[model samples]
Each structure stands twice: as structure tokens, then as C-alpha cells.
Target: MSRLTAIIAAVVACLIFCLGWLAMHYHNAASKQQTRAESAEQQVNAAEAVTSNVLTTMTIFNTISEANQHAKEQIALDASGASADIKVAVASDDCALRSVPDGAVKRLQQYADGLRQGAGGSATGKPDS
Candidate 1:
């Protein structure tokens, strides 16, 4: 009976130790998992920030490109009109060379105004030719 009692005590002690060990092992694993999750979340946030910055830059570039295109079109239209006026002046016998100069100047002024507006600047209050 004494030997049996001693054997039982040893078994109970071993069982308690095993349970404690298992609890500590599980706790460590949970902590490691939490750390990994937090790291992944931070990485996701960083990636989102980078994507946002890239989008903003692209938007700005598109706006600038649109402005440049508008300016170019305005300039081209003015040039075409000036050319037509010169052609008409050449065909007319009564039209003086001074008349062609005036028309050309007016068209150049309009082109300058368009460029100013496209550059986000105020126009010089010049009338369109």
C-alpha cells in the first residue's frame, strides 16, 4: 500500500508539470502569432501610403498635361488666323502692309493671353482677335 501511494504521488506530480509546460508553450505561440499579425498590418499600411502618393502625383501630372495641351491649341488657332489674314491682305490691292502688321500683332496678343491663362496666371485683359 505504501509503495502504491508513492507511485500515485509521482504520477500526479508528472501530470501537473506536463499541464504547466503545455500552457506555457501555447502562450508563447499565441504571442508570436500576434507579433506577426501586427507586422503584417504595418506593412499593409505602408503599401497603402505609397499607393496614395503615386496616385496624387499622377493626378498632378495629368492636370499639367491638360493645361499644356490647351495652351498649344490656343496658340495654333491664333497662328492659323494670322496666316489667313496675311493671305487675304496679299490678295487685296487696296490693303496696305500696315494692315497685315496690325492683324498679326492682335493675334499674337491673344496667343499670349491664352498661354498666361493656361499657366494658372491672370490674363493681361487683351481682347481676342
Candidate 2:
């Protein structure tokens, strides 16, 4: 009878040890899974941020392009009455200042100034020519 009781006690001890080992294994697996899930979530957020930035940049670029086209059209309309053989004087030296502005050069400078003003007037780079 004593020997049988000893055998039963040994079996209970073995069962308890096995349960503890299984619990530890489950905890380790759960921890690893949680870490992986967090990493995946972080990556998704980063990708979304990058996509949003790229889209915003593209929108700005398109706006600037449209404004530039509009400015070109305005300039063309304004210059319609100008002679086809318009002469633009060129400075031989970069440091030299022209004594008098050529007709075409003066118009170009005026257009540039208009463009600067328009760009400052709004977010878009449209010139108020």
C-alpha cells in the first residue's frame, strides 16, 4: 500500500511540472506574436505617412504647373501686338549693367515682377499679368 501511494505522488509531481512547462511555452509564444503584431502596425503607419506626403507634393507640383501655363498664356496674349522680330539685348559681361533696357527685355522683366507678385498673392504661382 505504501509503494502504491509513493507512485501516485510521483505521478502528481510529474503532471505539475509538465503543466508549468506548457504554461511557460505558451507565454513565450504569445509574447513573440505580440511583438510581431506591433512591428507590422508600425510599418503600416509609416507607409501611410509616406504615401500622404507624396500625394501632397504631387498636388503642389500640379498646381505650380497649371499656374506656369496660365502665366505663359497671359504673356503670349500681351505680346501679341509686339513685332515678331523682337530684339533682346544681351550683356557681354555678367557684371555689366545695361544703360537702357531693350523693349523685349523690359517686357520680360515686367512679366517676371508680375509673376513674383502673383506668387506672393496666393499659394499658387500664377502671375497676375
Candidate 3:
């Protein structure tokens, strides 16, 4: 009777040890999975942030390009009109040539030529022969 009781006691101790080991094993596996999930989430967030920045940068570049093109076109138009106005005023005696500095007129012509070339506009403000 003592031998049977000792055997039963040993069996219960072994079961308890097994159950504890299994619980610890499962707990470690769950912790590892949680860590991997968290890492994946961080990676996803980083990718999203990078994508957003890239899109914002592209939009800014596009806006700047458009603004530059528009400004160039406007400058070209203004140059052509100024030269034309000068020629008309001279011919009609609306303003004297001396009143308009030759140096300023030359600089304006140069600037207008560059703007027209860049903007792809035909030169229409030729001085009267």
C-alpha cells in the first residue's frame, strides 16, 4: 500500500512539471510572435511615411515648374510690349528717344530675347526701319 501511494505521488509530480513546461513554452512562442507583429507594423508605418514624403515632394516640384513656366511666359510678353511701345512712342512723338535711355532699352531687349527664346514665342516687336 505504501508503494502504490509513492507511485501515485511521483506521477502527479511529473504531470505538474510537464504542464508547467508546456505553459512556459507556449508563453515564449506567443511573446515571439507579438514581437514580430510589432516589427512588421513599424515597417509598414515607415513605408507609408516615405511614400507620403515622396508624393509631397513631387507635388512641390510640379508646382514650381508650372510657376516658372508661367513667369517666363509673362516676362516674354511684357518685353515684347515694352519694345513695341517704345517704337510707337518714338514714331508718334509721344515720347522722345532721349527720355528713354538707350542702355535700359538694350538691356530690356536682351532680357526679352532670352525670355522669348525660353518661352518659345515669336518676336513681334521689331523696331521700325
TM-score of each candidate structure, all chains considered together: 0.64, 0.61, 0.64
Model 3: lDDT to the true structure: 0.86
Ranking by lDDT: 1, 3, 2
- Number of clashing residue pairs, candidate 1: 0
Q: 27-80 in candidate 3: lDDT tens per residue?
A: 999999999999999999999999999999999999999999999999899989
Please, what are the lDDT tens digits per residue for candidate 2 over residues 1-129?
Answer: 999999999999999999999999999999999999999999999999999999999999999999999999988877863534343333355434545559767766766776767646322444445
Position 12, candidate 2: lDDT: 99
Provide the global lDDT of candidate 1 against the true structure. Answer: 0.86
> Candidates ranked by TM-score, best first?
1, 3, 2
lDDT of 3 at 127: 37
Question: Given candidate 3, what's the lDDT at residue 98?
Answer: 48
